[model samples]
Target chain A: MTANARANILSRLRATTTQGSFAVPDAPVIAGLALSLEERIDRLRRMLETMHAEVQVVSSSAWLGALKARLRARGLNGLLYGAETPLGAALEAAWEDDLPPLVPYSESVEQCREQLFHIDAGITTTRGAIAENGALILWPSAAEPRLMSLTPGLHIAVLEAGMIFNTFAEAIDQQAWLQEGMPTNALLISGPSKTADIELTLTFGVHGPKELVVFILT
Target chain B: MTKTADVLAFERNVTKALDDGQLRRNLRSAMTTLSQRRRALFADVEAFEKLRTQGQSIRRRALSRLPELLEQLEARCTANGIQVHWAETTAEANAICLDIIRRHGAQRVIKGKSMVSEEMHLNHFLEEQGIEALETDLGEYIIQLDGETPSHIIVPAIHKNKDQIAHLFHDRIPDAPYTEVVEELNAIARQELREKFRAGEVGVSGVNFAVAETGTLCLVENEGNGRMCTTAPPVHIALMGLEKVVEKLQDVPPLLRLLTGSATGQPITTYFNMITAPRRPGELDGPREVHLVILDNGRSSIYGDPERRATLQCIRCGACLNHCPIYTRLGGHAYGHVYPGPIGSILTPQLEGLDEAGVMASASTFCGACEEVCPVKIPFTEILRMLRNEAYARGESEHDVKGHGYRYTTVEALSWKSWALYNTSPGLARIGSQILGKLGQHLPMIGPLKEWTRTRIPPPFAPKSLHQLAQERGLDDDR
Candidate 1:
């Protein structure tokens, strides 16, 4: 039945007789203008901030201290981190004993579903960022899984300033996404989850993180 | 209006919708806000026009080679370990979904925002088979709780205000309290739907753009429910109309920019997800099995005609709806279809034969607001007018529009034929004008012109025709 359906549908489409090529004169790609790193960061910060996301820049060596202070200030008790990544080890080694507990995502979701949902925040290192739309491109892996940036109330994303790109196409090309084969799940997140479903009134944090705080390591 | 059973229902629904004060207020405010947001975002008119051209080119190029793209998409998806199914009709789509569910022995399914699933009526069908299907999107959840269909495509519950939603949650949700506060209502939905995401055995979602080169399904959503639906469950099923496919990954960015900017004036949605496969060996999360169902459902017939095929280029942005005068006034309910507004005016009839949904074409005033704001620049007024002709042609024309000439009646056809004859012949026209100048004022609402006069006042005729006055004034006449 499915085979016949495919055949019939394709045949009907092939039968269209009118001849006109659907081609447009090529032009420079829109949204592809190059920008300096400083301009990119400024653009990214401005766009995300308008959506209620917090963006802060800190020195590469001192960013963890800033993250700790922000988390402490917010009274977050548990911060979920990738257990297998190098950043996880660094976080573990530099942490003070009195600070919030760092929960390692060592188990499958089935084993830690409750804890995953209840954690104060989940932090992940972003693959790269898009400056044009103020988005973080996340390619989920074994260590920093898909749900680390989702599920929790607060998402703390750490990004290196150099990893930001001017546009989505540039990021895809520079990262060699098509050649490398696309990941199982890739995401471009610009802000905390939101919805305007209720009378077209915007409300934040319907099903994803209520707050998205970014720490750009300069 | 044409004298048909469905036309009467369409008129009645329009009247009923116009009478609803709350619905009118909600639609008016929402349309105003949405259009303003879009306008502000696209303030750079020249740049926006360039991007729109890019978007139009991408969609048209993909559609031109749709069959080949579908084949390539299927092959790449299969290579990535995701199963692909083809369905020619909504019924077949439903059957495929049921088969997948039964194979997994899944009793509970959670669905994200999928208009295609709504087209298939999958929720109601699954319920009859004893499987519980739940909607996880906050707006969809509210309407599902109330046992209602979506009025607007982008915002399903746009017809109801916050107060109405608060009342719905209080009455329907167990142990829920009434609250008009938007945040609290959203929190309630988030808490309720989170539980379903955890317990659901299967997840269902919609595809916004399917990249054929990489076999990737891209979903654009502001809420994370779409992510949860595809990730938290053990199995994920994605549904899309065949027109959603694009030729390459490079085609996505421009289209995405146009869609987001035009939909709600957002530079980008909160989350733009690109899924190429399910969970892999080392992945700690995401669904283990993924399936893609491509539905035809009369799209093949639409694609068979070059002129009508432009209808498939729509990205479902709803920008046209927000800009339409008729849609803003009546809201989405007046049209009474799965899809509504200007896009629906052309789409539903094409999909469901001219006889059944032909009245929708007449709903437009041809003001062209919808065409002006359309991101891809779909010639909406042209298509609407063309559909009206198709309905009246009744299969007499070469085109294969179903139920064509459904509006034709012997009396109406004869009257139009005679009217054409009398006007073309100068001798008969002069006599007709003389009669109208003498007695047109005394003419009553009768025959074909009766419906025309129902909402309109008859014009007072002058004592003489324009030609007679022109000749009396000694204007040059070739004759």
Candidate 2:
């Protein structure tokens, strides 16, 4: 039945469709912002902050120290992270005897359901950032997965300053994620979970992370 | 599920909607904020115009190569371990969704905001099969609880004010105290819908954009309910309009830019979840089984008509609705369809044909505000005029025109014929004016013109015809 339906619709479309090439456009740069990379990153910082998401940019030499200090300030004690990512291994290696235990994402949704909800914060690496929109692009990997960013109360994303693209189009095209087959899920998170459903009034953190704190490693 | 789709009953519905002073106030305030926010966001008029042009070209190209794109999309999605289904009508779409639910034996289904599902009235269909489909989006949840369809696309409960929602919550939920605070109301819904999300065996969502190259379905939402619905459930089923597919991943961002900006003036929505495949092996958390239903409920007919095919470019942003004077004045309810406002005026008829939803074409003021605000630049007013012409030419008055029945009835057709006769002959025009003036003096405001004159005074007929006066003044060419 479904096959018949599919063929019927496709036949209708194909009958009218012309066989031709198309113009694939370049990702246009934002017209007004004639700024350099450094300037764009600064603009991203301000934009994210305006939306109530905290953002900080630091040099790679100071990246680990800055992240640790920020997490401690937020009182995010328990952490679930990807065991195989570069940042994950570094954080695990840096853990001291007195620090909170590091938990790795489970291989299945059911296997980690309990730990996912109980964790105070989850950390992951963003594939890239769109500076113009103040968005962090995170392509879920087997190790990082979807729940790492979704279930935790606080999502702390680590992004490289160089990964920042001026527009989402630039970020998408530059990455060419399709070349290696897209991950199960990829996310472009701008701010914390929010809703204005009730009488059109804005309320933050309804379902996903209540707070999204980004650390940009230069 | 409680559809006001009898566009035939538009007058009664509009009367009821207009009587609710609270609804008017709510719609007025909401529309004002949306428009103001949008204007402020696109302060650089040139930048905004450039994006719209780019967005339009992207949509146009997608349609021009739709079949190949759709075939490629289906194959890619299948390769990604996602099941693909085709639905030629709303009935087929509903049946397909129910079959998926039955396969999963899913008693509880959490639904994200999907206008496609609403177009099929899927919730009611599920209810018939003894399955509970819970709306997870806060706006949708409110409307669901209230037994009403979403009045607006993006803001589903834009029709209800805080006080009304607080009352609804207090009445429906046990232990939910009466409070008009937005945060509190949201918290109450969050607590309720979250439990459903966890309990549901299946999640259903609508697609904002479907990428053919990547087999990725992009779902955009400010509320994370969409995430919960798609992520928490073991099975995720997405229903999309056939026209939502884009040829390339690059095609997505530009269209998305217009969607979020024109929809709510947001730089970006909170979550832009791209589902390229179901949860991969060894993935900790994501839907295991994914299905995508590409639905064509009269969309092919619309596609075949080249001039009007631009209607397919709508991203369902609801910007045109926010800016439309008729929509804001009457609110969505008065339009009497699952979709409403300017887009609905043309779309409802195009998708379902003019017999059922044709009355919507006349609902617009043709102010062209909708076209001006449309992100993809759908020439909405032009389409509305085209639909009107189609309806009149076919004498589709057999379909109800509600309170303004005369507009679509034989009376309207004869009125045009008579006017054509009078215009073609000057003697007939002079005589027609005297007769119309006599009729005007004696007649009470009645028929289709009654609705118009309810709050307006009819202009008195001229004592003499302009053509007659032109002839008398030896200026016959002016006639």
Interface RMSD for all numbered candidates? 1.8, 4.4
TM-score, candidate number 2: 0.91
Look at candidate 1 and give me any clashing residue pairs: B394-B404, B394-B405
Candidate 2's residue-wise lDDT over B77-118, tens digit each?
999999999999999999998988899888979899999999
B1-479 in candidate 1: lDDT tens per residue? 23477898898999999999999999999999999999999998999888887888888888888999999999999999899999999999999999999999999999999999998999999999999999998889989999998888888888999999999999999988889999999999988888888777999999999999999999999999999999999899999999999999988988999899999999999999999998998788999999999999999988887888889999999998898888898988789788899999999999988888888888899999988888887889988988888887854654567678888888879989999999899899899999999999998778657978888987899989898999999986676
* Model 2 error, position A173 (Å): 2.8
Query: Candidate 1: deviation at residue B169, Å?
Result: 0.8
User: Candidate 2 lDDT, tens digit per residue, A144-203?
Assistant: 888889878888899999888888877766787767668889899988899887766788
Top-scoring candidate (DockQ): 1
Residue B177 lDDT in candidate 2 = 90
The reply for model 1, stretches above 4 Å from the true place, is A17-31, A73-77, B1-3, B474-479
Q: Specify the poorest-scoring 10-residue window by lDDT in model 1 chain B.
A: B394-403
Clashing residue pairs for model 2: A109-B284
- How close is every model to the real structure, measured as TM-score? 0.97, 0.91
Steric clash count of candidate 2:
1
